[model samples]
Target: MERFFTLLLILVLSCGLAQAQQKHSISGKVTDNTGEALTGANVYINGTTIGTATNAKGEFTLKNITAGNYQICASFSGFKRYRENIELNASIQNLEMSMEESTGTLGEVVVTGTGTPHHLKTAPVPTELLNSQMIESAAAPDFINLMGSVSPSFDFSPNTMGSFMQLNGLGNDFIVILIDGRRVYGDMGGMNDLGRINPNNIERVEVVKGASSALYGSDAIAGVINIITKKSKRSISANHNTQYGTYNTYQSTTNIDFNSKIVSGHTTFSQSKTDGWQNSPYEVDGDELVETDEMTQNAYLRRNVRQDLEFRISDKLSIYGGGSYYMNDNKRALSVKDYGLFFEDFSYNAGAKYLLSKSSNITFDYTSDTYKYYYKYNQTKEGKYEAGDYQLNSDQRRDDYNLRWISKLGKHQTITLGSELVQEFYRSEGRLQHDEESVNTLSFYLQDEISLFDDLMLTAGLRVVKHDNFGTIATPKLSALYQLGHFNLRGTYSRGFKAPTLKEQYYYYEKRGTLYLGNTDLDPQKSNYYSAGVDYNNKWLSTNMSVYQNDVDGLIAYENTELLPGDADNGIKKRRQHFNIEEARTRGFDVMVDVKLPLGFSFGGGYSYVDAMNLTEDIRLDYVARHYGNVRVGYFHHWNNYHLNVQLLGRLQDDKYYHEEPNAKGYDLWKLTTTHQLLHSNKVNLKLTAGIDNVFDYVDDVPYGENRGTINPGRTYFVGVNINFAN
Candidate 1:
């Protein structure tokens, strides 16, 4: 493996050096119709790979371009595409372009569904996009809540295990989460620690539904969510944001960036703390309500730091690296003694890219993530509790390496080829009797996109994976899109597969009077997914509707077995084991509509319906809701040099069904937020925000351990301030 990588590196460097000697460069600036600078606008040569984005001053430079005649274009979201003809010579060429704002969604660009960039209206596969405007308007504290509030197909609920997340009736174990194209690893009781993400640093979020194993592998059976972070192109820039809310909740973040001709660096530091609240002070024991012995919600504190740097070694070669550290401390309140749950994570990544020419490139990246969980027991001395640590519960480590090559074959075709290697190691003193266990996976994939005609596009992809325990598996996907005037129709079919994790196959534990055991002979799960959708866009309105069905085989779940005769006298000792004994199906439909009304007003809403069932037992799936929806309204006004905006958001859900407990009732929630731009200047900007959540002060006081319709802590108010400076 080492020799192979060494040889590839040598080949890439040689090609880059040869190409560097005979290339020219292009420089330009992009602006709006009013001659105002437009930052982050993309400027590229048509039908080629040479491209770059405009800086803070709306200036861009595309280096290492071969001398030729090409069509140069500039594109930005909510703006018309600008094109110009140019001829490159031995010297650098400079130009300027202007664009006009549009009221349609056709200008948006998406990259998550296909692993290649394309306009949202022309993408063969369906994709959902949420920009910074929507994210900020919602004023959500974390990623899970942000998604749940904006998307009808997504749902979240707080629990003792963690925050339970479901997408189209599928659980978190089947979903894949990515940050800037890299996967985020670490889960506590089947839930990922979404708090580690810095919400203020996000630029956008993209969602792709149905199976995506052909491009990402394994756990992408349910869907994929990719988060893109903010980037600055100024010489130096800094931002500070702070928020204070009810229940002693606080959040603050600081970001700094420095960019030069050849080197750029970015850093972020953030902290969040919340004194959690309980809606109920009672518990249900069979048929009676009793006083609660423990707090329903636990308080938590989190701190995180991240840094990234990039070096442009000539125009044809660039190297980048980054690392992050995050820690969380959770406190539980009990009548007897309070216990603590602590978590720590450390991650590092590095990557390099080599541009083969104007239309091709090869890149390599590596990442390592380590996560640790600890339990602390407070000791009682005299009349007070002292801080004392107890045991290390679990430790997990993951390493990944990827190499990819992308090229434009001709005017109407593009190709992508990639390979990935992943390694995982886990140890748990409470669940596993052994010291540790590990698993490895290797995958290779190929994808092709063809522009069959002016109004038709087709995409095909395939992936082959080899796992240490599951042997070999194959996944395939096909999609097509047809555009007619202002409407687009798209369809897709895909296959997905998932291998059992090491912990799921070897761990054993006892909880709440029940013993659970894992089976080493478990079979891998597989699924077939089908989807169809239509999109309509015009100057004033945009609408989309999609329907999907997923059929899964050999699903893994815990089943109750007979109790041992020797333990019958002690109590009702039930035994549970993981088995692949059930087949399941989930079908859903999603509809969304947005209209831009007159007088700086906009209205939008969405609805989702899901039917999840266990075919083997003819029963409804647990934690799945049949119907859910959201509505949003906003008004924006600008006077003189100040801007003001107001937004109202509401969410409603139908009853949720479960097999082992009572059904959860339906509920409604509402929120109102107002933002004011106090100052806007050439070098600095300041903004303030205030909001009220759960405006009606509605609360569900259901007892602990039972399903609750809503977990909101009634009416809450918050205030926030943001400051930015650039030079």
Candidate 2:
């Protein structure tokens, strides 16, 4: 491979020519808990990037910085974060910061758990953050209602042909979605399109459950969800947001940012729509029960746009490029005659980075993605389909190449090296039985992190893969951390894999007269995971508890097979194919909590438990739900221009197990949110939000093709507006 990228560009220019040092400065102001004066707020000096923001009287200086004991962080994006541990040797004046409205952000900074960067209370893995004030106090409208309102071990399963994600009971091809850290492409059956992500352009959310597969390879078996977006560290910035509700649902977004002196820019636009509703219009007509207008959630529209650029050829190199465009439409059934779906996507990326000092760096990335799936045709249909005919149903493509290095080898060791390449192409011609297929993967990975002083930490990783069609593979992982004193203790062991998606081999479909087939000799789905966690944070509580066990092998599902040679000459004698599944097990437990009280009240919640099994047909894994739970309550106040927040959220689940008969009824839902920061200024900012989702009006109404729990249309109300501008 070009002499291994010319020996990694001569070892990243000999570590960017060794070093440079001598610098100092610090100054700050930023305030919030009743002292109010937090304009723009961001003040940094933790692991370099020096940083600043706060002006307009919430003052901030932080200049050249570099001499000694660090961690002087301060942040503000819906409050709560401030860290201190200074000793900068010279130049320090003023410096006093505070932030509140706490919802527990354990000293921020997380890099999706050990891909580098840690702190979310000393991470050695076992991460889960979700910030931006718990997604604007849970007035969610996207990313599947903000991961079904503040994730407690997420499981979002919506299906009418798409939607999937489950962690703890592993599914959807075993989880791994990312943005801003790449990796996010296509899926409809194995699920993607979480509406092309835009929770008003999020700024936080990071979860790392078990099996990182030696740093994200082989699909990370059931972990990783990093979606960090939203950037604007001012030179200029602009934003706009919108929202509307119930059965006419809507959301809109716009953003732009630009910085100079060496260029940086970002632009985005978003739109989403819905006119969907219905909860059981009666179904099951074999033993009698009728009436239908189809749509227990289906009526959609989506659009997204993105553009980016960056160039700063010095200060240790930088380069970047970007592109995106996406569209979606799914609206069918006012009673079915079927055929209403279409998707479009196009993506592009380019990258470069260098800075082998100050806690190292060297990165390169290239990505290309394409997705298309269609059906369209909503009118005159005859054999083989017609009318507005679009019919293409599947054609996905993806490509990626990444190279990385981060080295710090002195002062508590850190090392990481990586290389990856992946390419996939698939096409369906009326649902494949051969039209096109391709796959490739190449990987190399190594990681190390150690601290051993001031409380233990350790990480180890290794990954090696080369698969044309499942050839060599190796994965390993181990992690540990121990703090004690505000407690933290963690552990992990991993080896995970999942390969076998190309619509699980190959396919041909037919539904409602039943018949489906696929399996070109599939294999590759392996795992072994184990975990343990315990965390307890201070300054008014934060808690975490975890336990996990996974052991999967083969596991591919869809059985019944017996015909597919012209479907038994068109007699179609029982067909369903896609095999595997010999043993499976998923065990879980997670619990989390937050608290912070004293005049402004706060409380949080969590609970999740999953148990999946099928040890050679012992059963219990169909639409799994062993138990689940959720909750939240909050209040905040500060009025200098108008700032208020009130929140209440609750969720519950249980009973989603099934060998048969209705199972999928487990409910409890509530919401009441309010955020008003009317007009706060540095340059300008305004916000308003209101909500009342499902609140005491839970509906499972299940009767339309069974299995249900929440298509939530109970009590709904919403309002939103956000505006910001800075210079």
Tell me the tens digit of each residue's lDDT in model 1 across 216-329.
Answer: 775687899889887666667898988788988888889998877578899999998889888888876667888875555577898999999988776567788999999888
Residue 648 lDDT (model 1)? 92
- The ten-residue window of minimal lDDT in model 1 covers 12-21
Top lDDT hit: 1
- Report clashes for each candidate as comma-separated counts: 0, 0
Backbone clashes in model 1: 0
List TM-score per model, in order. 0.94, 0.34
Cα distance off (Å), candidate 2, residue 688 = 19
The superposed Cα distance between candidate 1 and the true structure at residue 538, in angstroms, equals 0.6
Q: In model 1, what is the error at residue 100, expressed in angstroms?
A: 2.6
Overlapping backbone residue pairs in candidate 2 total 0
Residue-level error in angstroms, candidate 2, position 484: 57
Please list the C-alpha lDDT of all candidates, in the order they appear. 0.81, 0.79
Candidate 2 residue 713 C-alpha distance from true site, Å: 6.4
